[model samples]
Target: MADTTGTVEASQPGRYSVPGPPPRPRSQLVGTGFAIAAGAMAVAGALGHYMARRHASGIDPGHDWLAGQSVPNPQLVYALITLLVSVVTAHWAVWASGRGERGHTWVGMALTLVMGLAFFNMVMFSLNRMEFEIGSGEWATLAFAVTGLSLAILIVGMFYLGLMTLRSLGGSVGRDRSTPLGAAVFFWDFAVLAWAATWYVVYVVK
Candidate 1:
Protein backbone atom coordinates (compact mmCIF):
# COMPACT_ATOMS: atom_id res chain seq x y z
CA MET A 1 0.00 0.00 0.00
CA ALA A 2 3.03 2.29 0.10
CA ASP A 3 2.96 4.62 -2.91
CA THR A 4 1.08 2.05 -5.04
CA THR A 5 -0.31 4.69 -7.49
CA GLY A 6 3.17 6.15 -8.11
CA THR A 7 4.54 2.68 -8.82
CA VAL A 8 1.81 1.85 -11.36
CA GLU A 9 2.29 5.16 -13.30
CA ALA A 10 6.03 4.61 -13.51
CA SER A 11 5.56 1.11 -14.95
CA GLN A 12 3.17 2.13 -17.80
CA PRO A 13 4.18 5.35 -19.55
CA GLY A 14 2.99 4.14 -23.01
CA ARG A 15 -0.53 3.53 -21.64
CA TYR A 16 -0.98 7.27 -21.19
CA SER A 17 0.65 8.38 -24.49
CA VAL A 18 -1.73 9.46 -27.29
CA PRO A 19 -1.28 8.29 -30.87
CA GLY A 20 -1.18 10.72 -33.81
CA PRO A 21 -3.44 10.41 -36.85
CA PRO A 22 -2.55 7.97 -39.61
CA PRO A 23 -0.59 9.07 -42.66
CA ARG A 24 -2.72 10.23 -45.57
CA PRO A 25 -3.14 7.88 -48.49
CA ARG A 26 -1.03 8.27 -51.66
CA SER A 27 -3.63 6.77 -54.00
CA GLN A 28 -4.89 10.16 -55.11
CA LEU A 29 -1.59 11.04 -56.77
CA VAL A 30 -1.20 7.62 -58.33
CA GLY A 31 -4.72 7.66 -59.71
CA THR A 32 -4.18 11.12 -61.15
CA GLY A 33 -1.02 9.95 -62.94
CA PHE A 34 -2.92 7.12 -64.61
CA ALA A 35 -5.71 9.48 -65.65
CA ILE A 36 -3.22 11.93 -67.18
CA ALA A 37 -1.49 9.21 -69.17
CA ALA A 38 -4.77 7.92 -70.59
CA GLY A 39 -5.91 11.43 -71.48
CA ALA A 40 -2.62 12.23 -73.22
CA MET A 41 -2.84 9.11 -75.34
CA ALA A 42 -6.41 9.87 -76.36
CA VAL A 43 -5.54 13.44 -77.38
CA ALA A 44 -2.48 12.28 -79.31
CA GLY A 45 -4.56 9.75 -81.21
CA ALA A 46 -7.17 12.35 -82.15
CA LEU A 47 -4.50 14.78 -83.28
CA GLY A 48 -2.84 12.05 -85.36
CA HIS A 49 -6.16 11.29 -87.03
CA TYR A 50 -6.56 14.98 -87.84
CA MET A 51 -3.11 15.10 -89.41
CA ALA A 52 -3.82 12.00 -91.47
CA ARG A 53 -7.03 13.50 -92.76
CA ARG A 54 -5.28 16.72 -93.66
CA HIS A 55 -2.55 14.84 -95.51
CA ALA A 56 -5.13 12.74 -97.36
CA SER A 57 -6.79 15.93 -98.61
CA GLY A 58 -3.58 16.63 -100.58
CA ILE A 59 -1.68 19.84 -99.82
CA ASP A 60 -0.96 21.12 -103.30
CA PRO A 61 0.67 24.52 -103.86
CA GLY A 62 -2.64 26.40 -103.73
CA HIS A 63 -4.89 23.92 -101.93
CA ASP A 64 -6.16 25.14 -98.56
CA TRP A 65 -6.90 22.49 -95.94
CA LEU A 66 -9.32 24.73 -94.12
CA ALA A 67 -11.22 25.53 -97.36
CA GLY A 68 -11.11 29.28 -96.60
CA GLN A 69 -12.29 29.21 -92.98
CA SER A 70 -9.89 31.59 -91.29
CA VAL A 71 -8.63 30.71 -87.81
CA PRO A 72 -8.23 33.49 -85.26
CA ASN A 73 -4.51 33.19 -84.75
CA PRO A 74 -4.10 36.18 -82.44
CA GLN A 75 -6.78 35.07 -80.01
CA LEU A 76 -5.45 31.51 -79.95
CA VAL A 77 -1.99 32.82 -79.12
CA TYR A 78 -3.33 34.90 -76.25
CA ALA A 79 -5.27 31.90 -74.90
CA LEU A 80 -2.15 29.77 -74.94
CA ILE A 81 -0.24 32.48 -73.11
CA THR A 82 -2.96 32.69 -70.49
CA LEU A 83 -2.81 28.96 -69.93
CA LEU A 84 0.97 29.10 -69.61
CA VAL A 85 0.62 31.72 -66.89
CA SER A 86 -1.96 29.57 -65.11
CA VAL A 87 0.52 26.72 -65.08
CA VAL A 88 2.96 28.87 -63.16
CA THR A 89 0.32 29.91 -60.65
CA ALA A 90 -0.89 26.34 -60.20
CA HIS A 91 2.62 25.20 -59.42
CA TRP A 92 3.07 28.14 -57.10
CA ALA A 93 0.06 26.99 -55.08
CA VAL A 94 1.57 23.56 -54.60
CA TRP A 95 4.94 25.03 -53.67
CA ALA A 96 3.47 27.38 -51.11
CA SER A 97 1.29 24.64 -49.67
CA GLY A 98 4.33 22.48 -49.12
CA ARG A 99 6.14 25.29 -47.32
CA GLY A 100 3.14 26.16 -45.13
CA GLU A 101 2.82 29.62 -46.64
CA ARG A 102 -0.97 29.75 -46.46
CA GLY A 103 -1.30 33.32 -47.73
CA HIS A 104 0.82 32.72 -50.82
CA THR A 105 -1.02 29.47 -51.47
CA TRP A 106 -4.37 31.20 -51.49
CA VAL A 107 -3.14 33.92 -53.82
CA GLY A 108 -1.70 31.39 -56.21
CA MET A 109 -4.90 29.36 -56.30
CA ALA A 110 -7.03 32.44 -56.90
CA LEU A 111 -4.80 33.70 -59.69
CA THR A 112 -4.76 30.31 -61.37
CA LEU A 113 -8.56 30.16 -61.31
CA VAL A 114 -8.82 33.59 -62.88
CA MET A 115 -6.31 32.71 -65.56
CA GLY A 116 -8.16 29.49 -66.37
CA LEU A 117 -11.42 31.38 -66.81
CA ALA A 118 -9.66 33.90 -69.02
CA PHE A 119 -8.32 31.14 -71.23
CA PHE A 120 -11.80 29.66 -71.58
CA ASN A 121 -13.25 33.03 -72.50
CA MET A 122 -10.55 33.61 -75.08
CA VAL A 123 -11.15 30.23 -76.69
CA MET A 124 -14.87 30.86 -76.83
CA PHE A 125 -14.29 34.26 -78.42
CA SER A 126 -11.94 32.77 -81.00
CA LEU A 127 -14.47 30.10 -81.88
CA ASN A 128 -17.10 32.80 -82.35
CA ARG A 129 -14.79 34.74 -84.60
CA MET A 130 -14.15 31.65 -86.75
CA GLU A 131 -17.90 31.16 -87.35
CA PHE A 132 -17.43 27.45 -87.72
CA GLU A 133 -20.30 25.38 -89.10
CA ILE A 134 -19.94 21.77 -88.11
CA GLY A 135 -21.92 20.63 -91.17
CA SER A 136 -19.75 22.60 -93.59
CA GLY A 137 -17.18 19.89 -94.30
CA GLU A 138 -15.02 17.15 -92.81
CA TRP A 139 -12.45 19.71 -91.83
CA ALA A 140 -14.99 21.71 -89.91
CA THR A 141 -16.26 18.66 -88.08
CA LEU A 142 -12.75 17.51 -87.19
CA ALA A 143 -11.79 20.98 -86.04
CA PHE A 144 -14.82 21.25 -83.80
CA ALA A 145 -14.27 17.78 -82.39
CA VAL A 146 -10.66 18.51 -81.46
CA THR A 147 -11.40 21.87 -79.92
CA GLY A 148 -14.41 20.57 -78.04
CA LEU A 149 -12.41 17.73 -76.55
CA SER A 150 -9.70 20.11 -75.39
CA LEU A 151 -12.24 22.44 -73.85
CA ALA A 152 -13.88 19.54 -72.05
CA ILE A 153 -10.54 18.67 -70.53
CA LEU A 154 -10.06 22.24 -69.46
CA ILE A 155 -13.46 22.28 -67.78
CA VAL A 156 -12.60 19.17 -65.80
CA GLY A 157 -9.32 20.69 -64.70
CA MET A 158 -11.03 23.88 -63.56
CA PHE A 159 -13.60 21.93 -61.60
CA TYR A 160 -10.86 20.04 -59.81
CA LEU A 161 -9.07 23.27 -59.11
CA GLY A 162 -12.15 24.72 -57.48
CA LEU A 163 -12.60 21.66 -55.30
CA MET A 164 -8.98 21.77 -54.17
CA THR A 165 -9.27 25.44 -53.40
CA LEU A 166 -12.21 24.75 -51.15
CA ARG A 167 -10.32 22.02 -49.36
CA SER A 168 -7.35 24.34 -48.86
CA LEU A 169 -9.54 27.06 -47.42
CA GLY A 170 -10.99 24.55 -45.01
CA GLY A 171 -7.46 23.88 -43.67
CA SER A 172 -7.33 20.40 -45.14
CA VAL A 173 -4.23 21.32 -47.12
CA GLY A 174 -0.92 22.13 -45.47
CA ARG A 175 2.78 21.27 -45.37
CA ASP A 176 2.16 17.56 -44.84
CA ARG A 177 -1.15 17.54 -46.67
CA SER A 178 -0.47 19.02 -50.08
CA THR A 179 -0.98 15.93 -52.19
CA PRO A 180 -4.51 16.90 -53.22
CA LEU A 181 -3.35 20.29 -54.40
CA GLY A 182 -0.43 18.68 -56.24
CA ALA A 183 -2.80 16.35 -58.06
CA ALA A 184 -4.99 19.26 -59.11
CA VAL A 185 -1.95 21.13 -60.37
CA PHE A 186 -0.82 18.14 -62.39
CA PHE A 187 -4.22 17.84 -64.05
CA TRP A 188 -4.32 21.58 -64.76
CA ASP A 189 -0.90 21.42 -66.40
CA PHE A 190 -2.08 18.54 -68.57
CA ALA A 191 -5.11 20.55 -69.60
CA VAL A 192 -2.86 23.39 -70.70
CA LEU A 193 -0.65 21.05 -72.70
CA ALA A 194 -3.68 19.49 -74.35
CA TRP A 195 -4.87 22.93 -75.46
CA ALA A 196 -1.40 23.80 -76.76
CA ALA A 197 -1.38 20.67 -78.88
CA THR A 198 -4.84 21.56 -80.14
CA TRP A 199 -3.64 25.06 -81.01
CA TYR A 200 -0.63 23.77 -82.97
CA VAL A 201 -2.61 21.21 -84.94
CA VAL A 202 -5.80 23.17 -85.49
CA TYR A 203 -4.38 26.68 -85.93
CA VAL A 204 -0.61 26.84 -86.46
CA VAL A 205 -0.30 23.91 -88.87
CA LYS A 206 -2.79 25.20 -91.43
Candidate 2:
Protein backbone atom coordinates (compact mmCIF):
# COMPACT_ATOMS: atom_id res chain seq x y z
CA MET A 1 0.00 0.00 0.00
CA ALA A 2 2.97 2.30 0.51
CA ASP A 3 4.05 3.68 -2.83
CA THR A 4 2.62 0.58 -4.59
CA THR A 5 1.60 2.57 -7.68
CA GLY A 6 5.07 4.08 -8.06
CA THR A 7 6.71 0.67 -7.73
CA VAL A 8 4.44 -0.84 -10.42
CA GLU A 9 5.09 2.04 -12.82
CA ALA A 10 8.84 1.76 -12.33
CA SER A 11 8.78 -2.01 -12.96
CA GLN A 12 7.00 -1.62 -16.31
CA PRO A 13 8.53 1.54 -17.75
CA GLY A 14 7.24 0.74 -21.24
CA ARG A 15 3.76 -0.43 -20.15
CA TYR A 16 2.34 2.55 -21.99
CA SER A 17 4.11 1.46 -25.15
CA VAL A 18 6.84 3.38 -26.94
CA PRO A 19 5.85 5.52 -29.84
CA GLY A 20 7.03 4.54 -33.30
CA PRO A 21 9.38 6.66 -35.35
CA PRO A 22 7.98 10.00 -36.31
CA PRO A 23 6.52 10.34 -39.76
CA ARG A 24 9.01 11.52 -42.34
CA PRO A 25 7.30 14.69 -43.53
CA ARG A 26 9.19 15.11 -46.76
CA SER A 27 8.92 11.47 -47.61
CA GLN A 28 5.22 11.52 -46.93
CA LEU A 29 4.74 14.50 -49.19
CA VAL A 30 6.60 12.82 -51.99
CA GLY A 31 4.65 9.67 -51.39
CA THR A 32 1.37 11.55 -51.58
CA GLY A 33 2.43 13.17 -54.80
CA PHE A 34 3.24 9.82 -56.29
CA ALA A 35 -0.11 8.45 -55.17
CA ILE A 36 -1.95 11.38 -56.73
CA ALA A 37 -0.06 11.00 -59.97
CA ALA A 38 -0.84 7.32 -60.05
CA GLY A 39 -4.52 7.99 -59.53
CA ALA A 40 -4.48 10.53 -62.33
CA MET A 41 -2.81 8.08 -64.64
CA ALA A 42 -5.37 5.44 -63.82
CA VAL A 43 -8.24 7.74 -64.66
CA ALA A 44 -6.53 9.01 -67.77
CA GLY A 45 -5.82 5.55 -69.03
CA ALA A 46 -9.42 4.47 -68.62
CA LEU A 47 -10.81 7.52 -70.34
CA GLY A 48 -8.22 7.53 -73.08
CA HIS A 49 -8.82 3.92 -73.99
CA TYR A 50 -12.56 4.40 -74.12
CA MET A 51 -12.14 7.39 -76.39
CA ALA A 52 -9.63 5.68 -78.62
CA ARG A 53 -11.92 2.73 -79.04
CA ARG A 54 -14.86 4.97 -79.78
CA HIS A 55 -12.86 6.93 -82.29
CA ALA A 56 -11.76 3.81 -84.05
CA SER A 57 -15.31 2.59 -84.12
CA GLY A 58 -16.52 5.96 -85.49
CA ILE A 59 -18.96 6.45 -82.67
CA ASP A 60 -17.97 10.14 -82.46
CA PRO A 61 -18.24 9.91 -78.72
CA GLY A 62 -18.24 13.53 -77.51
CA HIS A 63 -16.28 13.00 -74.32
CA ASP A 64 -13.45 11.32 -76.15
CA TRP A 65 -11.94 13.90 -78.43
CA LEU A 66 -8.62 12.09 -78.16
CA ALA A 67 -10.16 8.69 -78.78
CA GLY A 68 -9.84 8.23 -82.48
CA GLN A 69 -6.41 6.75 -82.84
CA SER A 70 -5.71 4.09 -85.48
CA VAL A 71 -4.24 1.66 -83.02
CA PRO A 72 -5.71 -1.83 -82.84
CA ASN A 73 -8.47 -2.48 -80.32
CA PRO A 74 -6.61 -5.23 -78.51
CA GLN A 75 -3.56 -3.04 -78.09
CA LEU A 76 -5.60 -0.23 -76.66
CA VAL A 77 -7.21 -2.60 -74.23
CA TYR A 78 -3.84 -3.99 -73.25
CA ALA A 79 -2.45 -0.53 -72.71
CA LEU A 80 -5.42 0.38 -70.57
CA ILE A 81 -4.96 -2.65 -68.38
CA THR A 82 -1.25 -2.08 -68.07
CA LEU A 83 -1.61 1.54 -67.10
CA LEU A 84 -4.33 0.82 -64.56
CA VAL A 85 -2.33 -1.90 -62.86
CA SER A 86 0.79 0.24 -62.84
CA VAL A 87 -1.03 3.14 -61.27
CA VAL A 88 -2.82 1.11 -58.62
CA THR A 89 0.30 -0.68 -57.42
CA ALA A 90 2.31 2.51 -57.57
CA HIS A 91 -0.12 4.28 -55.30
CA TRP A 92 -0.04 1.41 -52.83
CA ALA A 93 3.74 1.51 -52.79
CA VAL A 94 3.72 5.22 -52.13
CA TRP A 95 1.35 4.79 -49.21
CA ALA A 96 3.64 2.15 -47.70
CA SER A 97 6.68 4.36 -48.18
CA GLY A 98 4.91 7.18 -46.38
CA ARG A 99 4.47 4.87 -43.39
CA GLY A 100 8.28 4.37 -43.09
CA GLU A 101 8.50 1.17 -45.09
CA ARG A 102 10.55 2.62 -47.87
CA GLY A 103 12.53 -0.24 -49.29
CA HIS A 104 9.68 -1.89 -51.11
CA THR A 105 8.06 1.36 -52.15
CA TRP A 106 11.32 2.66 -53.52
CA VAL A 107 11.89 -0.44 -55.54
CA GLY A 108 8.36 -0.48 -56.89
CA MET A 109 8.36 3.19 -57.81
CA ALA A 110 11.75 3.02 -59.48
CA LEU A 111 10.64 0.07 -61.55
CA THR A 112 7.44 1.82 -62.58
CA LEU A 113 9.22 5.07 -63.34
CA VAL A 114 11.71 3.50 -65.71
CA MET A 115 9.20 1.10 -67.18
CA GLY A 116 6.66 3.86 -67.62
CA LEU A 117 9.08 5.82 -69.80
CA ALA A 118 9.66 2.78 -71.95
CA PHE A 119 5.94 2.19 -72.13
CA PHE A 120 5.40 5.74 -73.33
CA ASN A 121 7.94 5.27 -76.08
CA MET A 122 6.30 2.03 -77.14
CA VAL A 123 2.96 3.79 -77.33
CA MET A 124 4.40 6.47 -79.59
CA PHE A 125 6.00 3.87 -81.77
CA SER A 126 2.69 2.08 -82.01
CA LEU A 127 0.92 5.30 -82.92
CA ASN A 128 3.33 6.01 -85.72
CA ARG A 129 3.02 2.50 -87.00
CA MET A 130 -0.78 2.51 -86.90
CA GLU A 131 -1.53 6.08 -87.97
CA PHE A 132 1.25 6.67 -90.46
CA GLU A 133 1.64 3.09 -91.60
CA ILE A 134 5.30 3.37 -90.84
CA GLY A 135 7.28 0.27 -91.62
CA SER A 136 10.24 -1.02 -89.71
CA GLY A 137 12.93 0.93 -91.49
CA GLU A 138 16.30 2.01 -90.15
CA TRP A 139 14.91 4.24 -87.45
CA ALA A 140 12.43 1.66 -86.33
CA THR A 141 15.13 -0.99 -86.29
CA LEU A 142 17.33 1.14 -84.12
CA ALA A 143 14.48 1.93 -81.82
CA PHE A 144 13.66 -1.73 -81.34
CA ALA A 145 17.31 -2.49 -80.68
CA VAL A 146 17.47 0.12 -77.97
CA THR A 147 14.16 -0.97 -76.51
CA GLY A 148 15.37 -4.55 -76.30
CA LEU A 149 18.52 -3.48 -74.51
CA SER A 150 16.48 -1.35 -72.15
CA LEU A 151 14.14 -4.21 -71.43
CA ALA A 152 17.08 -6.38 -70.46
CA ILE A 153 18.32 -3.73 -68.13
CA LEU A 154 14.84 -3.26 -66.69
CA ILE A 155 14.49 -6.95 -65.91
CA VAL A 156 17.85 -7.02 -64.23
CA GLY A 157 17.04 -3.93 -62.23
CA MET A 158 13.75 -5.42 -61.04
CA PHE A 159 15.47 -8.61 -59.93
CA TYR A 160 18.15 -6.72 -58.09
CA LEU A 161 15.67 -4.46 -56.35
CA GLY A 162 13.46 -7.36 -55.36
CA LEU A 163 16.39 -9.21 -53.87
CA MET A 164 17.53 -6.18 -51.98
CA THR A 165 14.03 -5.55 -50.65
CA LEU A 166 13.76 -9.13 -49.43
CA ARG A 167 17.12 -8.85 -47.75
CA SER A 168 16.15 -5.62 -46.06
CA LEU A 169 13.08 -7.25 -44.56
CA GLY A 170 15.30 -9.67 -42.61
CA GLY A 171 17.78 -7.04 -41.52
CA SER A 172 17.67 -4.38 -38.78
CA VAL A 173 16.98 -1.68 -41.32
CA GLY A 174 13.48 -2.86 -42.19
CA ARG A 175 12.73 -4.76 -39.00
CA ASP A 176 10.88 -1.94 -37.34
CA ARG A 177 8.65 -1.43 -40.34
CA SER A 178 5.58 -3.48 -41.18
CA THR A 179 4.17 -3.18 -44.68
CA PRO A 180 3.58 -5.28 -47.74
CA LEU A 181 5.75 -3.16 -49.97
CA GLY A 182 7.54 -6.21 -51.30
CA ALA A 183 4.28 -7.50 -52.65
CA ALA A 184 3.71 -4.20 -54.37
CA VAL A 185 7.12 -4.38 -55.96
CA PHE A 186 6.41 -7.85 -57.27
CA PHE A 187 3.06 -6.70 -58.57
CA TRP A 188 4.61 -3.84 -60.54
CA ASP A 189 7.32 -6.10 -61.84
CA PHE A 190 4.69 -8.44 -63.20
CA ALA A 191 2.77 -5.56 -64.70
CA VAL A 192 5.89 -4.34 -66.48
CA LEU A 193 6.60 -7.75 -67.93
CA ALA A 194 3.01 -8.09 -69.01
CA TRP A 195 3.14 -4.70 -70.69
CA ALA A 196 6.31 -5.69 -72.47
CA ALA A 197 4.68 -8.84 -73.76
CA THR A 198 1.64 -6.92 -74.88
CA TRP A 199 3.81 -4.35 -76.64
CA TYR A 200 5.62 -7.09 -78.45
CA VAL A 201 2.39 -8.62 -79.62
CA VAL A 202 0.80 -5.32 -80.56
CA TYR A 203 3.77 -3.51 -82.11
CA VAL A 204 6.59 -5.89 -82.88
CA VAL A 205 4.50 -8.63 -84.40
CA LYS A 206 2.69 -6.14 -86.53
Q: Identify the candidate with maximal TM-score.
A: 1
Alpha-carbon TM-score of each model against the true structure? 0.88, 0.34
* Residue lDDT tens for model 1, 1-206: 56655543465857777899988788998999998998899899999999888888865511467776566699889999999999999999999999888888999999999999998898889888888799788888988998888899999999999999999998866778899999999999998999899999888885
Model 1: worst 10 consecutive residues (lDDT sum): 2-11
- Candidate 2 lDDT tens digits, 1-206: 56655443365766679898886444533553464456446434543443344455435533232233333445444554555666665665556565666666666566555555655555655555554322434233333443344354445435544554564456413423423444435444544544454354434432
Clashes of each: 0, 2
Candidate 1: deviation at residue 4, Å?
Answer: 14
Worst 10 residues of 2 by lDDT: 62-71
